[model samples]
Target: MRRYVFGRLGQVILTLLIYVTLVYFLLQAMPGDITMMYLSNPKIPQAAREELKKQLGLDQSLFMQYVSYMKNFFRGELGVSFSQYPKPVWDILMEKLPRTFVLFLTANVFSFYVGFVMGKVIAWRRGKVIDYAATVVGITFWTAFYPLLALVVIWIFAYNLKWLPLNQFIDPRLWSAAPFTANQVFGNMVYGAAIIGIGIFFIFYYLLRGLKPSRRSRAQAWALACALIAAVLFVAARKGMLIYIWDITRHMILPVFTLTLINFAGTMLLMRDSMLETVQEDYVMAARAKGLPDKVVRDRYAARTALLPTVTSLVLSLASSMSGGMVTETMFSWPGLGQTLFAAALSNDYPLATGALAFTGIFLLIAHFIADILYAVLDPRITYTGQSGV
Candidate 1:
């Protein structure tokens, strides 16, 4: 396990190193430097422009500048933003990271569980009316008009009806005061925790319940119920339940739904194919021929083996979450890294742009590495033979 983890980690570091180098050269190849954007505004004089360029190190050799940038990046110094004077690039990213994380993580969990279960159900009833209907609906919703559907919903509910806030993070009113009191911070944390707990419980409870031993296993049922209740109460104590529910539900609904819809078709189809194939495998046939219960054969032989492919795909889906749906974030006005990166690109803030790119590259590389590790764990038939696993 230690070797596997270290190998993957090494690969991630190397990938990031290559990505950073490529990004630096690519930025260098762009038409103009950050100063040009500011200079074109006509407000600042040429003298001021020259001074600003000097201050920002645009006057230095390209090699020297690149070296300096890399050094600072390694030290977690993302350099100053050309647009936002005196603000470090790292600081901006930190401010936006949490919103993106919450949105993406929620979407991933929803999509994976929903797709996984739906795929199993369809596989169990393959070639039937229900299976065909589900396939059609899933394909249409996921492929034909996922983005448009989300936009329409947001427009109708948030714009036309004015029922939801169109864009932005939490209500500004919540943090307008200077030097927030300890009570306020504590209250906010507690409220946030409670909402997250409640949302998770509601979403995953059915899936967990369905996995219970038997319909008459009241003890197992009660245990799950208690677990759910305890989680909700614990979250409520840390963050008031009312605030938690309001924010999580309001802000999360559209994004989560959109992400789940986008991923549903692919996941469902993959699961269906894998399960169907597994059901025909010689081992599965053997298990069925031995007079085992149908449920036991399906679950133990079919479902277990089918899950290998799904597990790989699921890992990739989870990694893709960090990209955080650019269009969706724009539509919802959710404050996240996607929007921040968009702004950086539009403004030609080289340091900020490259910093965001580096961050994204690092995140993707790490996620891929994790997926590779999971693949090895799930299938002992596969083996890695590299100083750094890929």
Candidate 2:
């Protein structure tokens, strides 16, 4: 196991290096230099532009520049943004990243839960009305054009019904009187949400792990989890923090809803297919022969085994989501890593753009490493034998 982990870690490092190098060179290969953005203004003198280029180390040979960038990157210095001059690229990303994380993380988690649950039920109840209804709805949403769907959702929920915020991460008017920045509020929200998630997970784990398959015990567990959530919210309200969190959440509803609709269908379909295949396995038939309850047989014997592929897809999706959803962020007027990357690329902010892409690549590599480890844990038959596939 140790050997496998170390091997994967080494591969991650090598892959990250290749990804970063590619991002740097590709950005450099763009049509115009960063200085060209400034030179478009006639008042910016030629000598000043030359001085700026030299200051930015653009005057150096491509190889030298690449070497310097790699050195600085290893040392955790991402340099300054050309567009937002003098502000470090890391700072901009930091400010934007929390928003992206909060939004996509919430969306992905909720979508996965919904997909897994719905898929499990549909798969177990194949050919039933519920299965047909869910499959049709999921497919419909899945096949819809995402941007147009988002617009329609917004138009219905935000514009016509006035049920949610129209766009942007927060309502500026509401936040104007707040003492903290939106980033700070988002950070607090993330921490609060983490606590809530951990608390709920423990409730489900400790309360249901050894319990027999029954509606009563499951109901108790869910009740406790819901109570925990409410308690967290109550505490936040007592501490005068709920208002800020609520504001952000209200703004988040439309995008989260739209994203869930778009993504959950794929997960559901994948889970359903996997579950169908697993149900035909010998162990599942043995479980049925033992006269186990339908739910137990399906969940324990079939669903867990079927979950492997879905888990893999989920991990990759989560990692890719860290890159940010460009269209989603733009459509919602949300400032996130995706929007930042888009703007940086358009403006030729090499440091910011390259850093964003490299950051995403690193996460993807890490996710693959994690997925490999998870495979062994989820299935004992998946053993590490020092092979590349392992």
Candidate 3:
């Protein structure tokens, strides 16, 4: 296991190195100088532009610039953004990353848990009315009109109805003022706590319900505990003991639903097919012949084998997710890395663009590495053995 992990980690490092090198050169090859973009304003003199170029090391040969950039990258310097004034590319990413993390992590977790449970139920009840209905609902909800649905909900609830706030992270009023009083801080915490607790319960109920019998009981208990906490917080929030959870949900909900819906059909289909295939396998037939309960056979013999392909699919999906859904983020104005990358590309911000590319590559490499490890874990017959194609 150690050997397999180390080997995959090595490959991940190599992949990232190669990708970063390629992106640096590709960005360098693009027309129009970083300095030229700034100097085009005509306020800066020729000598000042030359000095800036020299300072930025853009005056050097392409090879030298690449070498320097690599050296700096190794030292954890991602270089400065040409488009943004007096800010490093890394700094901009860092500032935006927490928001993206909060949004994407929440959305991914919600989708995976909910989708997995729905898939499991459909798999177990294959060919039944319930299964068919779920299939139709899942496909329709996730694939066809999920984004439109979210839009309509937002329009009705937020814009027309005035029940929720529209677009923006947190309430501006809460953030605009200087140091908050203890009461304000406590109020904010109460509201935030309630919102998160309630959101998690709604999103993860299916996941808890789908766990193995031995695990599901414990998960239910935990869910109950969370419900109690959420209830308490909700009461506090109502009494002004807590501030209203800032209505970031408007900006957050669409992207979350879009991602979930985009991935739902494929996940469900994959699960259905995998389960069917597993049920038909000789081992499953043998288990059934041994007079094992249908549930036991399904869970122990079938689901285990079915998960291998699902893990592989999940790994591949990570690349698309981490690339940052440009169209989705742009349409919703989510202010995620996807939008940032798109903006950089349009403005020809080489440093920011290259940084974004590098980040995407790193995410891909990590996702692939994780998938490789999971593959080994899911199937004992498959061995890494320090060689390719386990």
Which 10-residue window of candidate 1 scores lowest in summed lDDT?
177-186
Tell me how far the alpha carbon of residue 240 in candidate 3 is from the true structure, in angstroms, after superposition: 14
Worst 10 residues of 2 by lDDT: 205-214
Best by lDDT: 2
Candidate 2 per-residue C-alpha lDDT over 1-390 given as tens digits, one digit per residue, 9 for 90 to 100: 788788879889988989899999999999998888776699999999989989999999999999999999989999999999999999998999888888988888888888988988899998899999999999999889988999999999999999998999888898889887888778878878889887886777654345456678888878988888888778778867778888999999999999899889878989999999998999999999999988889888889889999988788678755653888998899888889999999989999999888877876787788778778766778888776565
lDDT of every predicted structure (CA atoms)? 0.73, 0.86, 0.70
Candidate 3 off by > 4 Å: 36-48, 130-153, 161-163, 177-251, 285-297, 382-389
lDDT score, candidate 3: 0.70
lDDT of 1 by residue, 224-281 (tens): 6677667765755565444544554576777787788888777888989999998889
Candidate 2, after superposition: displacement of residue 378 in Å?
2.7
lDDT of 1: 0.73
Give lDDT tens digits, candidate 3, residues 116-161: 6666667877899978897887777655654566576558766897
* C-alpha RMSD between model 1 and the true structure: 5.0
Q: Identify the runs in model 2 with alpha carbons over 4 angstroms from their true place.
A: 198-235, 319-324, 383-389
Question: How does candidate 1 fare on TM-score?
Answer: 0.81
